[model samples]
Target: MDRKKAAILALSLLTIISTDTVAPLVKQISASYPQVSSTMVKLTITLPSLLMIFFGLIAGQLVKVISKKAILAIGLVLYSIGGIAAGWSESFPGHLILRGLVGAGTGLISPIITSLIADYYQGKERADMVGYTFAISHFAAVITPPLAAYLGAEDWRKAFIIFSIVPLVFLFTMIFLPGTARRVQSDAAEKRKAPIPTKAIQFALIALVMMIIFFIVITDLPYLIETKTGISPIVSAFGLSTCTLGATIAGLTFSQIYVRLKKWAIPTSLLACGLGFLLITFSGTSVLILGGLLCIGMGIGILISLIMLVTANSAGEADSTAAVALVNGGFSIGIFISPFFYANLPRIELGLPAVEFNFLLAGVLFAAAGVIALLVAISTNKQLNLPHR
Candidate 1:
């Protein structure tokens, strides 16, 4: 790959690596702080997401006034510092605070990466670059879990060390990433205030729902495997890796899939996810669970790339960063709320174990969503075929 693409791809890894890298350590971190509520412990995983929502939007505006590279560098510095410091924190509150810093940093970084891709590449090239972006990030996801599991095997603190790589990425950004001038808007254009495209908002909402469904695997699967199969947490972590493995494959193939599937792509991806969740619900063994996760991964992989492409294309250059940030922020919100949303559901009234029930619920929702998407796709196709008045 060329230097610019390589630098962007490396930056991609930083967006997701911190969360996935620390996921395996969640249970262990909870064990260390017995007085803390389970929800609080899980916040260690989700808190960054909460911060990302606000920071991402802030980043959208920042890019208008500052160079994208400068914004990225600042975020990297904060992310590296916060993520590494959180590992050594003795107090749970302090740890969460640091995690917030990490999230804020991520929020700042996330939109810039997508906006950069939208800025630099176009048409099929842009679509392919988006795919490659997700592919590289998911590829990192595939590697980090097992490594984090191993590193945190004896001490959960060690896993945070993964964040240290941010410094190298920062150096790469400075050395390789070309600087773009700040966006200069005319006074008339500024006063005119072009509205964000409605389609962008629609896609962002879709992204929100998709993320809620997708994160069920990430936030709940380890506990599911541990409780149902009595497997080592390492195995559970591996299950997480399998999801990303499938995602990586999907990312690598997204261009071909999009070309062929066209309007049907979203529905097909949703159905695949629904099927995967059903497999996880019924499967009795770890192998089956991993298989299910892989399927889920593939579905989400295509779905996310599709959303990014459509949302970017819907907006003008001036609105690109904010539009993309809206979708990414939706993702963070869904992820942040997932555990609480699933946990609060009346699983007891439904007469099912929590984890299994969460998976089953997600399966049913995705299946229903798939049906809806199919209908919408058919309607849209029919509309396009209608003669113009």
Candidate 2:
């Protein structure tokens, strides 16, 4: 591939990395600002999702008015500024506001990733690219937490400096990403808008559930380990990193999985996560927790790729960006709401410990989702095989 395409793909990886830049530092930040609620601290990682939800939709529509490259370039600048400024804030509330700016930047850039790929590629190549995008994005996940943990170890504020990379990406994007989205826009508009398929929404809802489950593990992980196992936050960061490694493996092999399993791939991934979380519920050692996290990550990796593909394929060229934006918005909503949702779940009467009980509840729900996906796949297969009059 040429430098231009590589640059575009790199943007996809950057988006995921930027979102979690503060994740490893969440515990440190919360400790630094004891006056703030734990839920508010977690919002440092999730609050961006609120803007991402709004801007994702708005960005999709803006494709009609501005070039994707231009929006992307401007977003990169905002992301860099917000990420760096958050570190300088003396107040937690001030930091939260800066993170929102970072999220606004992400919202502008995120939806365009799929749209750009859709604009530039098609058919089997497109599918392959989608899988590769997930692989690379998960590969970033594999590296980011440990890196953030290391940086945060010195000072939580230093971790925010990682956002400086945004400027480099911005420079590459401005120079390499093509200027022809304008022409593509005209062509896309000429094509009649098709209704987004119902399957897209169904897949998105499942993705939303998967994201919520995934975030539950991440958002609670440091405190859960500290409170239950007396482990260091660094250990939880490594455990989370292990999950990303699992996701990286899944992402790299997803096309092959898709070829053999076809419609079964999504459910199979979900099942892996469900089983993983269940294992974590009973985990007696760090090893078991790491193993469970791996399963969850692997499943989430595949689900994300599958959902993006479904949304992009289900809509017309013109609507593909908006469709993808909507799906992404659903995932962002899940992230934003995860802390509160888990907080409100009725505690089980079982003898399980608090964190263990939460994992058990999440495990059962994820497993149920997998079962439903399987049934839906089978029913759809049968319907497809039936003869039409």
Instruction: Point to the candidate with the largest lDDT.
Output: 1
Which ten-residue region of model 2 has the weakest summed lDDT? 380-389
- lDDT digits (tens) for residues 1-389 of candidate 1: 77788889989998778688888888899999999998889898888998998998898888767778999998999898998999999999999999999999999998888888877777788888888889889999899888988899999999888888889999998898888633444563562365667888888787777777778788777777756765445456588888899899998899888888877888889998998999888887767777788888899999888888777777765547788888888999888888888878765566667788888989989989999989999878542111111
Tens digit of per-residue lDDT, candidate 2, span 208-294: 766776787777776567655644444576877787788778777776776777778868988998998887777667777788888
Instruction: After the best TM-score superposition of candidate 2, give how far the Cα of residue 119 lies from its true spot, in angstroms.
Output: 0.9
Best by TM-score: 1
Question: lDDT at 244 for candidate 2?
Answer: 77
Candidate 2 backbone clash number:
0
Candidate 1 clashes: the total is 0
Candidate 2: clashing pairs of residues: none
What is candidate 1's CA lDDT for residue 117? 83
